[model samples]
Target: MKNLNEPTQENVEFMIEEIKVKLRMATAAAMQASSFTVERYEDIKDLYEVVASKEKFSISEVEALVSELGQLRK
Candidate 1:
């Protein structure tokens, strides 16, 4: 999310789109679910919670999450 910082209408939309993409990819997989899938699911769940919660994300927290996402690709 370039801007899923709080609950701004735009940011919520962005977060929803991001989650949808993840969900679609997961569902589209022909292979059986594995630990990797589980991990990604958990990550999505955590992201949903963060975006859904009323609390605003701190700069450091967002940075950490961004870093985590980058690491996930590797």
Candidate 2:
């Protein structure tokens, strides 16, 4: 979305924090194993794109989706 251009500073920061949250959940589920997989990377990229476009999210819904995506990664 947003023509695939770079996000604003606020959006970039938000995406970074959101990605960290998702990564942490994924890593915890992986249980000391590697969580850097194609699916995980795609999840990060897709969510970043969404956030960059919408610039808004419902915390509960986003966290739930993030958790599901974590499971999907591996």
Candidate 3:
């Protein structure tokens, strides 16, 4: 596993990719890791943790998460 404690571009990319996979996002192709930055690392990590803890999610939950991610984007 990658060491995600550090706020690095690579770590951000890893977390974003993992979140996308875990969420089974239909628009995963549109949400590239390059769209994110270390400036929002903590927010992204928080979202990643929320996503990682759940095996499934309701449509509303997914929408909310996606919206949060959109807000965090550069």
Candidate 4:
């Protein structure tokens, strides 16, 4: 497994993919990892951790999370 604690492009991509899967996002095709940058690595990691720690999410929660992600995007 990749050491996600490291803030590298690969790690950011991995986390973004994992987040998409975990959220079961319908519009995931629009949320490409390439849209993000290493500068927002910490924020992305925090979002990843939140998604990872949860098995399911409410509709509102998912909306809020996606909104935050949109804000963090390049």
TM-score between candidate 1 and the true structure:
0.37
Off by over 4 Å in 3: none
Best by TM-score: 3
Which ranges of candidate 2 are over 4 A from the true structure? 1-18, 21-34, 39-44
* Model 3 score (lDDT): 0.94
State in Å the error of residue 45, model 2. 2.7
Q: lDDT tens digits, residues 1-74, model 2?
A: 23324434444344545555444444443332244344344455576556446544577756765665556444
The all-Cα superposition gives candidate 3 an RMSD in Å to the true structure of 0.6
In model 1, which regions exceed 4 Å deviation? 1-39
TM-score result, candidate 3: 0.96
Cα-based TM-score, every candidate: 0.37, 0.37, 0.96, 0.95
Backbone clashes for every candidate come to: 0, 0, 0, 0
Regions of candidate 4 where Cα sits further than 4 Å from its true position: none
lDDT per residue for candidate 3 within 1-74, as digits (tens), equals 78899999999999999989988999999999999999999999999999999999999999999999889999
Model 2 clash pairs? none
Greater TM-score among 1 and 3 belongs to 3
